[model samples]
Target: MNTLFTVSVRRISHVCTLKPYKETKWLMPYGNPTGIYVYNCVANQRVPVILSDPHIATWYSCGPTVYDSAHIGHASCYVKLDIIQRILKSFFNVNLVTAMGITDIDDKIIKRGLETNTHFTNIAKQYESEFWLDMNSLNIEKPLIITRVSEQIDCIASFVKKLIDSELAYVSKTGSVYFDTSKFPSYGKLSRMQDEGEPSDEEKKNKMDFAVWKGHKPGEPYWDVPWGSGRPGWHIECSAMVSKVFGSQLDFHAGGIDLRFPHHENEEAQSCAYHNSRQWANYWIHVGHLQVKGDTKMSKSLKNTISIPELLKTYSADTFRMACLTSNYRYSMEYTDAAMENAEEVLNKFKFFLKDAIVYINNNTATHPCQYKDSILKELQKVQDGNIEALKTDFDTATCINNMLNLISSTNKIIKNDSSGYYPVTVTLIVEYITGVLTKFGLKLQDGSQENIFSDMLIDTLVEFRHTVRLNALSKKDKELLNACDIVRDKMKSIKVQINDSNKTPSWVLIK
Candidate 1:
């Protein structure tokens, strides 16, 4: 819904007994009344998200055609959706089963194969492997099920045959099949596409009709289906794959906002015709485009695409992920060096605080907490709850991320002052909270071994300095120098470092 900030007066049925919703202001585009109101592109309104069973939800998302490298635009869609999926799981407790279709048999793949004098399947497989690698590199969670168009030819054929039998589709003279949009009364409801009276194609009865199966042509791969020896259409591939995976019903349908038009609309029509239901998917989700320098949408056709591998080469995964989170998912974001730099700064803030906090806990922790009471733990809990609220209202990551950062700032102040805070329990709990939020967004964290090495280096530096001071005091028998050694000893005691000074030379042992 990147192009959508349209107002709606219609109210949807979202009266789930499990949770109650409060009225919220729709002042901003992704504003509150945030009781899980998902933007529906079909209705052009923010419809309240409601599930029938509310226990398990079924979802399907469209995947790339896999003819070439997946770009940042593609990464933007999948990564943002993955964040929303995480929010749904953590905040709403919705156990979702998602499936994505891989378009391995497409015109682009065949054309590339022909140009390279290679087999189409080989071309498809090569890019398909690259697609998965890009997805893993971005840390996007793998879908529960994956369906490839090449492997699903028979199932797609069956779906098209059913539509033909119902008279909602027809077999063209060339043995190609097209959807008869004239027959389906609700043909343009999803996209609301008005007929501009464009001339009809030689093979189609109406200008609105689109191919469900393209008849085989010279130098093209084909399967011997009952209709013809050709592959499936791009739109029909999703409809058939969804039916094959989740049967007639689905809880959610997701894709990039660019797909809202003919792609998603066509899928809805064919699936509804196949299932004999008014609704093919209960909720529709679409993420915005990732543009370059705030220009037009990035695409291979425009030669404006930045590949995911190329971006990852320059910046960490957390950098890209943080950049995306800075803007809400439903709005198109500009990818600039400035934007990435800002994201890097934000990431380092939390990261440095976490690292320093952990080291402080390890080296300055006593057997008990601070002697005075502090309300830092309660403040951390409030941040966590505030994040939940932000996500509930359409996954507003901008607000949620700000909340986490604010808590980190305040906690850092308290820790720096050596204030009346419980370092043992409060600091430990703060670490857990920050770690959870970072992991939730798929941001990489320092590994356990790496943190241990860093801590050891700090201890080595401290022990070497203390040893130097101790030798001076023992050799000179200087009382003032000896008192400085006592100060170091008191500091070491807090970290369980025991020093013995009852000898010519003092020895210290680090407690495990």
Candidate 2:
């Protein structure tokens, strides 16, 4: 008998250390006080998330089949799922344990090996490394447990044996093993797929039945088992990994919408049959497809798919994330150059606003008790409330982003008016709040590392030189000196730097 696995949880003293600004009249609850709702694909309804343990949550996502380089289509699914995890951690303060499975020994990997005359293991490792590089480039959070199908063959074999002993599966004439779908009446509960007329192949007993283990073929990898010598089937691999890592039940199961049919449905059926529990997962979340601009799905055969490495070459990770956030996670988004360009523009605007605010706070030391503080605080509270509310309702990142934009606009308006005194404390709080929220979305203010000390000194020296030149020009009314100042401004702009001349001292901000 196989022992069920249980997750160990440790009590964390502080999940979030950032405090809200001055504890306003509006108190935004951190935990799921009102019950967070998530869209469940099995029920086809938005269901409230009921956690098995209040302090910890367990979730799983289907990972890549390491046959080739991962494309943007894969990136979209992972990034969206990362956002979901971030929301749970940042907003709900839940300790999360997430797992993803890698199919390293799939049919596709075998085919690639034959075509290239290379070892399948070498190919799997090459692409797996590339996949991690691309994931890092996109700033995706790493899963706690990344199980490869190759490493779980023994477990998979044991699981297949259990089904066989129970007569839920059988050994075929070809020495292969197949799942007897007839034994499980709720086989199509997840996919809602109906049986076709007849068995497609004469060798199989039923058309609905799928392979649990394949017989060994010529020049293919195989493992010795009691009944046969072959590899585990695609569906059995995931089920086995989940069983070993997370046991029978999962808090959430997420992947692209394309996996809903045969891939995820089969896994669910086998898990339910083996564990004898109808509730395999509490919530099944599926992200929409990332389509090409012309309404065609991205596919390798179409030769129109964009790889993550190629995308990062042209755009920053935050830019790509921002483009994904522009649409709802449950709706399809078109990948066009125009869409990415628009995202970049929005990101630049945010950087500029943040730079200006930081500069104003640094230069001005006088704290003015502004008449507009009460009004601004009220508006900020409303925006914060809207952001929290949007995320609570199925993690609507688009709406949350809209609320952040509103907050930015309000901040800009207050700063634009000279009559309203600059409240340093209030501005600091707003900046903290904005950056905190943006970080949760996997976006940061600066793209790369900060400027080195020497580079910073060079910039300061140049700014001081321009200031001296401008002063001389004003005192002596010299056109040449003024023209030299213009030269400095143009030079800075060419290097993607913006100079602010409104303050007593000239300050520069780098534009990523």
Candidate 3:
């Protein structure tokens, strides 16, 4: 069984400790696209963002095929959905639950099973475990409930029965139940496929023509259903799961842009056929693809993919989060060593600032009130307010995170140049606010290292243990050691105190 964790509003501090990812009131709400059409890989046409009712928002994301490990592109989709979920809870004050289902039943599983001469269930288990490990390493919160296609046969059959009774679905001679696209007039509305053009003749001939229930096939998983013994099609599996879990109406449905076509489009068509209603999702959000080097989709089929487990072994989870946040969820981004390096560098800088701030807080002697207390509070409010407003305008995460980085940069500068200690109130207010926000994003301010003591320890340990004696020392012994240790520590620990103490003498705050 998978472990689950929930955050109640009352546990504000406990929630604060999460890695730099949180839902704030100022984040985006569930609604229609307000301005500028985002590229919809589903409709193949850019549609205006339109949000329906906010109170009843729910989400569903198609999960990984447990036949393989997760890749960077998969991480991109999860990050986008995570961002959307954050906005929904923060802005609408609505209970937003996301169900990400695993495709544990598929040809891929069968093929792997046959190749390895292993039981299909064991194959699925092995790959699913690998996927879970990868997602956890990326700091992604598990979905509310993960439904598997094989475990949902009865639900799929019931939904298929509805389509059949409504005359929207028909079982062909092959014993496969398929949704007749011709019966649904708005067949391609979600992807705007009809507006662009109709499916060619060959596209319609296959009985899997948007297979709702696949009849028994050799060497594949099957379950007894009203229609026959078969497996559910990829798209039908989601509709049935959603219906079983949350019913027909959903607040939002999200997946990678690549799934907009036959996958998501067919899902909408079949789901609507079950209800015979117009409303499905209040808002449909699709995340752009993550490109490999040279602008190619990072997919396993192409043999050009970066597995999450391999990535975590090298870079920290926070590094991955930072990389994803650096790009807007709507835009396609290339994953390269350069981008990862930049994100790591920036994160390191923030860590350094946080360490300095912590030390400064601990070392402060004066009890004077902060001068710009109100001003700092006002700035924080602006950030909180502005970030929410920007997010509402189509989940502009780039703007949101940019605002956060700007605030971090400004706060750091203020801590470095504390000429007049009058603004202690302002300093405290800003520090508290930043810490709160960083907590939401799951980044914590690390502490517990003795500033002077650790400094002394480093000097003794480094000078005594290493053989480079009588090194060219330009400054005093203390200053020289501080500089050397600063390089060794890379300014990560020293910056914590800088944000908290403004009155300290202007000297090496433990390297840049």
Model 1 segments more than 4 A misplaced? 1-35, 363-375, 419-422, 447-512
Local distance difference test, per candidate?
Answer: 0.76, 0.76, 0.63
lDDT of 3 by residue, 1-512 (tens): 11111222122111121111111111122343334333444334343443344354567888888887788789878866775676556454556677988888888888998999998889888988888877776667788889988787778788888888988888867668878876766566655554224434333443235777777987677887766788877788888999888885765678887887878878877876686555455356778889987679889889988877677777777777777766778778888889889988876776676556545544346454232344545666799888767665566656766776777776666667666454433444345555544444544333334232233332332323211211322233556544543433332242332211112222223333
The predictions' CA RMSDs to the true structure, in order, are 10.5, 12.8, 13.7
Instruction: Give lDDT tens digits, candidate 2, residues 345-432.
Output: 8777777776666665454454433322657667767878888878888999888777777777878876666666765435544665
Model 2, poorest ten-residue lDDT window? Answer: 1-10
Which candidate's TM-score is highest? 2
| Steric clash pairs (candidate 2) | none
Tens digit of per-residue lDDT, candidate 1, span 67-117: 898999999899998988887776677888989999999999999999999
TM-score of each: 0.79, 0.80, 0.74
For every model shown, the clashing-pair count is 1, 0, 46
Better candidate by TM-score, 1 or 2? 2
**So what's the TM-score on candidate 2?**
0.80
